[model samples]
Target chain A: MTDWTIDSLVTALRTRRISAVEITDDCLARIDRLNPAMRTFITVDADGARRAAKERDSDLAAGRALGPLHGVPMAWKDLCAAPGLPTSCGTRTRDYFVSEMPCTAVARLVAEGAITLGKTNMTELALGPFGDNAHHGHVQNPWRSGHCSGGSSSGSGSAIAAGLALGALGSDTGGSIRLPAACCGIVGLKPTYGRVSRAGAMALSWSNDHLGPMTRTVRDAALMLGIMAGWDAADATTSRRPVPDYLQGIDRGIRGLRVGVPSNYYFDEVDAEVVTAVREAARQLGTLGARVSEVRVPDPVPLGEATGVISRAESVTIHERLLRERPQELQPVVRTRLEFGEHIAAHQYLQALRGRGRLTQEFLRAVFSQVDLLIAPTIPEPAPEIANVTTGGIDEIIKKMGRFSRLTRPFNGLGLPALSLPCGFSTRGLPLALSIVGRPFDEATVLRAGHAYEQAAGWVNRRPAIG
Target chain B: MNPSSTDPGVTAELTRLSDIIERLSRGLGLADEPASFVTVLEEGAPGDD
Candidate 1:
């Protein structure tokens, strides 16, 4: 039961093969056993989880059932607010403040009957790329001890990989969700910016931030996205467009689907193993009938620079008070990054904002004209040892941060949907991931391509040696 | 479906005429771009989930 996906749990619960209590207990037991070691959970609400499960069971007995995720247990990245639980956002600031209202994304799932175990850990202020949090303790890669778990959605990724939760909600600004998902060998979807409401979530960079699901399977990602994505009056940025039933066309396959393997930037300086695995994945997609060919993607370096400008500017605004008052309380990495924003000129920020539209238009016209999606490595390399990333000096840390997140940053600036899923594993047994990036608001095609590749590659079943 | 992914149109107008010319040559009309993120947020635009 602990190993089941949301779909599997739903079927078992609806057929009376499993009780919500049993499912909840399995996850709690695993969390209790692993939290001390993995640091995946920042707060564990076992009692509330059990209570929710019991109520779900009672509803079943009374011939009433909750929506899509009824009886399924999941965890949320601490960045999103959940009532009755503190959303630490992986920092000392407002860690103990429990909001009266859960974030709309969390509330949406709660309305659909997804039982929550508690909040998973994240990078402090959801800023860093490595899952090392100076406040809540770092999340270790479930695949191997003392290895990077990836962040800013670190805990959510480790929890799903270790079977602590079936699925979790993770927010992505740059590579938060996708990197963690890649490192942990799961599926992560960073839906188009504004696809999911960010009403109650902790703000990082308002323009760059995105919210989506991290789950064990592609369809599970679809199931969660189906419920979480929609127009929200609470979030003015959310799309007025209707959400699609992502799962409907998911298995339709990629027979004639065009997949571009970038001839330039996407593969540049990427580790040989990562490049090989993703290339192999593109080959697998071709075998699955996708029309695969080489194509030149617009250089994302300029877009990446714009991402930094907007993110730094907006991040400073979000943390202005906390940074001004509690300067000494934040981690050096967090503090340094925020302070850098103060130096960005208003005109420079405005210039970056202006560049976003042009860059997005250029990217769409140039690349998407030939291909429905592009396939590339999610992270340039597999998870480095935890000791290596954490012990570096500030300059070294900054370098590592930029390099690690470089590949995923441009998409955030472009506000395009990108999906990262397991493609293969490194010789050292760390997970390698393939990213399927699609046109703005085209998460369905991204997920469909990923599903086709994942099914043919058969990498989804190989969970890490954690549980 | 979510309308060209919210260009956050406060800066929606191209700052330079040349930028529009570049876009036009690239085959993307002004109409190809969705309205700014602030505008065009009308809920339930066809194909309601």
Candidate 2:
């Protein structure tokens, strides 16, 4: 049952080899068995999911047209409102919060016949990178217990890896989606900012936040993106950039495509094992007819720091009322991080915002001019142990957590499309990932390149042992 | 750098990062090109209908 990918489940349902109800039941059984150790779900809607599957079966029996994701079971990060489930955002402060309606993104997925199994757990307020939640017990990495499943989309990543769900929606303010994907040996896409609506999702950093899919396969990512990416009048930031048939060009192959390897910044402090795995991934792409070459990237320390300033300031603004009212409810680390944002000067936040545009355009011109995609390690190293991160001194904890996000956050500032897929495994058997980045609104090319590399590298077929 | 550091120390570190960011952006000559609100606008032509 853990072997069923999203595509296989879709094929089985559409071709009548399996009923939607049966698939949903199998998924529920798996969740029941694995979720105690994994703690990937905050809420499990067994009744609602069962009812939705029955309705889907009725529609299929009547020969009605099916949505692209008909009868596929999935989950949403607790950051987003799902109609019946509580939107916890992984904090005690939000324990009682539930929305009147599903977020625009989830609404679209439901309309397309995807069943919401439940809401996945996340970091408290999505502030930390290591899937650690003092409120909800830290999410255990299915690849190995005690090791981390990256955050703030912790459960979304853990669930997919443990075979509790086929695909899940994970939001990324800064590497929330990709970090977990890398750690869990899955595929995650942080679609270009504003490519999907965030009308009803919890706000972390409004400017940097992106909503995208985390799945086991690149094709599933493309499929989910097509269903969810488009203009939403509710979320004006969503691009008028027309959505493409992502799966249409996905298998087109990356023959002769230019792939850029950053000469600096990306690999500066990366682990030797991670560098070896990513470079080997690049070599595989080159062998598959893509020209892989090293290119200079602008010093990213400033850019990454700029993104941090903007995100923290914005996050504090969003949570100010809560902090002022119920400061005691937040986890200590999240509270301290939010309170620290109050010290960032208004002029400095403004300067960082202004620098963002200059840096984004400069990066586009410098890198994309030479390559169609940029290849780098998704995180500097493999996932560390959860206890190691949470039990450390505050400064050491911040450094350990920030290390995973260093390579990924700069892209959030630029708002480009980036995908993280498993490239190889470390000697300790932890998954390592390579990120594929492309020009804004060019997710098709990113997916195509990732799909091609995934096929060539062949790392995603191996599943983590959850039992 | 203790987990239990005083608020003054935390504030000082944040202030230093803020100073660094301000210095870094001071000469970029991007005063007129704000980045936050352009994504929803007409691609780069923000004022266009």
Best by lDDT: 2
Best by DockQ: 2
lDDT score at residue A370, model 1, on the 0-100 scale: 87
Tens-place lDDT per residue, model 1, A366-420, is 8877888888899999998888887767757877988999888888887888999
Worst 10 residues of 2 chain A by lDDT: A93-102
Which candidate should be chosen as best, given TM-score against the real structure?
A: 2
Query: DockQ scores for all the models shown?
Result: 0.05, 0.26
TM-scores for all candidates: the values are 0.91, 0.95
Q: Give the Cα error of residue A343 in candidate 1, in Å.
A: 0.8
Per-residue lDDT of candidate 2, residues A337-372 (tens digit): 888777777877888887777777667767777888
TM-score of 2: 0.95
Query: Each prediction's Cα lDDT score?
Result: 0.83, 0.86
